[model samples]
Target: MDEVSPFAEVLGQAIYQFTLIKPLLPTYGHLLVSALFPIYIGAHASLSKPSSAAKSPKKSQEDGYESDTEEDESLGDTHKMESLAPSDALMFPLTAGLTLGGLYLVIKYMGADLLNKILGYYFSQMGMLFAIAFLKDCFAVIRSFFFPRKYSGSGRIWKPKPAERVFQGARDDGSSSESLEVRHSPLPGILGAIPLPHTVRAALWTCREVAYWRARLRIHVHRLLHAECWLSVLDLLSVAVALPAIGYFTFVTKPWWLTNFLGFSFCYGTLQFMSPSTFITGSLILGSLFVYDIYFVYFTPLMVTVAKTLDVPIKLLFPRPAGPGEAPDTISLAMLGLGDIIIPGMMVGLALRFDLYLYYKRKGMHKAQAQGNGSDIVKPVYQSAMGGWGERFWTRSVTPSEPELEPPYHDARSFPKPYFTASIVGYVLGMLATLVVMQIFDHPQPALLYLVPGVLLSLWGTALVRKEVHEMWEFSDAEEEDEDSSVTDAETKEPVEAGKQVSLFSRIFSAPKEGSERPPKSDEANDESVDGKSDKKESPEKLELFTISLYHPRKRETSKLKAPTERGQSPEDDENWALVGTAERDAEPPAKRLRRSPRQH
Candidate 1:
């Protein structure tokens, strides 16, 4: 083995090991890096709801619209609601199959050179992007160290703001469940006046329409590709150009160091996308993967075979030592799959994020506890919208005996420096241990076997010692769904009872006979003009908007006033009649308001 050339000898050894494991294994590792890794990362990101909340605003908006439409169109809306459980179950296998099939096609027709060149180009561009990102982070970290206030000033705690509820009967858990729709004409632009080529104008118009949809799509993609550093639109355009340029170099020159750097950069990005949230999820994810790493590497040669067959930079390749004059290309490269890097890096990032949250929360809590008189640490002030000016302050009740101050919920903005520090320590130790094990066994070892334990021990162990394990384990930016579901089936009976009461009242006080008429009071004749003016003043505010609507102010003045209750009225008159009915109905007792079911538009 010492006398033979390193590349030839290592190749022979890898072949021998693969042969030994082939008889014991049922399948190959073709899709390990290509498909399964991506699918797993995607699934993990999707499952981690807290981290995925930013992406949900657009999704929630779409879902709200869908629900409204479904409710109107279908009586079986509840049954028709889509569940993601099936998608979760099938995501990985589907992704793997598609990816492997695509790879097979590319390989069969274009050859390995084409595949390598494409990957080389892609990773090279990504390398430049990551390198720019890495430098930006490094500068930020350095600046943060020197000017503490600048770093602290940049990120504010994501305090959940209370929203005005459209459904007043709904619980006020410091969240607004209201959605408002406004429709108006687009702002007049000079582009319409300025002459341009018809083709260019058509292209611009097409782009504007596409951008409207892309804005929604970009929100989801942004969460997945979140970079801490801020980049402007111009900066992004430059980056887009730089990516291809970097790829061109990687394809043409193929520098080993540059490729390795790009691999590291790519790893950094993947970690950002799939970073874990809580200790529990991280443990469950990493622990299962730890077992996976062992089974795939030790029990079968799938891991080794996959790493060898994949010529792409899915792994970091370190060149073996050679005599001074030896060519770099000839040197046998030591390969470590990206799974080993990204899995642990994600945990590390999670830990760091959590650690930052804890630090700020503790600081805020301490400040809250120190300020103001009494045993209470926080006194929540609930302001009534009806009130003219001053807010109503009250202490939040903790129990029957005492009230306690509430601290702010930890947010994602906090940097996880401590957890990051610990993970780095673990990563270094794990890498060294991997090198040692490989030397001792004289065969390849699963890098994750060392990496996972190193990360968990450093992160969880420190957490245990500090007595912050529970906080770290259950940390989340998103509020719990249990609170949101307080308006359950049991709570809905009140509305049903109210509906019955409304029915009873309608039956008891039947409408006046068709020929009946009421005598007008002496005051009514004098106030008729005043009432008409008041109606004009109030109509905009009282207008019933069941769906998004655009109303022209000029049309209201030009249109002739008609009797609102006229039987053979147009659609517009019918709307005014409904509005008048609502106003008259509001004069009933407050309790009666609850008793009457909402009128269907």
Candidate 2:
């Protein structure tokens, strides 16, 4: 027999180990799928409707009043009210530490039994609400899969003519708008040529009617599912499906499958709704939690004890085979905490968004360049791939309005997701490393210890390689400003009157001297003040200037202002005169300056 090579021996050993680990695959599979679902779904949703992700402060301010009215009529608010700021990221570790310590102390003193009961009751109620929401979302997804919204309201029976097309309703004037054009295949001509019987013709007519009705039914179902109401058919169906699951989980039995289901739902909801607004915030959060995980897992017994004692769905559990001398029916379990999945999952989600930002930014730059060069840029046409007869029967042949207007990069599937891909690969490797170490040591491992480094290193390394570190650093999801307090600085061409300058200085410095506040303005100064007010009102353009108080004594301000051309002095002479004037004003006592109004100066 030929001797086995070292590589062959290694490969054989790996296969043997994998076969031994086959039973644990479900546990890891659940963890991986649950962790990735939210990121994938959230990124797709944001990319599909890019407008909802971020809005310019200028646009928001300009449309603020209109948006207020629109909001009242809108079905739902999709924009996040609060995002994770950098300050929040800084404080998160402290807050988490306090909570963990408190929980540990409570469990140590008050007993885990009582604490678990109270927590279980609370979580059950909360989980019911979340599960109902999850069910509704699931129903929507399933409904869309069968009767897509893209094909809604486009049935063959309601087909419209090119020139004059009318939907179901007629105009108030009561004129018949148009007639539907029924498109039939050439099968009838082929049948006639073949000299088919009349019964066959009747059967063909029946099939045509069936096809038309199927299209009508599909359109109706799509409309029903997508209706914007609290108690639509879809909601009713979701409630119907959710009620039994809720009852079983609450009353019947909280089986491992049910526990895992609820845990996955909770993870999905959290990642979908909440996000660290920027990569820096995500990194800070992960870094803090990395230390938190290490402390809780290895240094103290709090984490392991709490995880094992708590009967809630906070951690995912997988059953292992009974050990030697144990009861044959007994089950030993392996557990992984939800935090391990969610904490690093946030970074992965942010990476996907960062990818999207880069994609759109590049697209905009290319479009601008093309426009600059006066090139005729062709818009891409999006077409859905053809499917079987059943799929074509349900979905309309007409292209959806949204896709028609969407650019080529609008679809999430086609996006160049180097950062997202890298993070996902890193996560898998880290998780496998964690499992390997756990197996070797015969101890539980804090998954985040490996996960955090894997995610962060992969993301930052990809950024360094791509030379996009600056772009990632600057990317933010927070709204820059709200409409109510929006104000921007404007540069003004108007010269600062000497009186205005003195008044500004007075405000900056202490009040005028104690005994010299008796001087009043003359009639000429009053006339000049009235004339200046008239000139301001008569000017066509009114610019609002936002000022910041600087302690530099107007040195920079003087340098920035243009000298008066009417003075007929050289630039150097004007500069010297301005400096002299400013110095004299500064040297002159505030009392002296206050004796004359700014108009007099």
Stretches of candidate 2 above 4 Å error? Answer: 1-23, 42-81, 151-231, 373-414, 480-601
Model 2 lDDT vs. the true structure? 0.54
Best-fitting candidate, scored by lDDT: 2
Q: How much lDDT does each candidate structure score? A: 0.43, 0.54
Residue lDDT tens for model 2, 1-601: 9999999999998898788677667766765666566556544433322312223221121110112112112212343523565555556667777877887898888888788777777777777766766676665555434332122122322221111211132232334524533322213112223544667645654543322221001101111121112234545665687678767876677777787767766766666566677788789888888888888889988788888877887877776676558997997777778887778877887787677666555554455465574453432222121112222343334333432223322242355789989998888888888887776577889898898889899999999999989988987755333344443211212233532222212334456556545455443344355324332332222211111111111122233344455645333322211111122233333322222122311
Q: How many backbone clashes does candidate 2 have?
A: 1
Query: What TM-score does model 2 achieve against the real structure?
Result: 0.58
How far in Å is the alpha carbon of 530 misplaced in model 2?
A: 42
Model 1, C-alpha of 114: deviation from truth (Å): 4.6
Off by over 4 Å in 1: 1-111, 117-241, 323-329, 373-418, 477-601
Please, what are the lDDT tens digits per residue for candidate 1 over residues 489-590? 345333344312222123345675554544432222322332232223333433222211112111122124333435554434222111112333333333
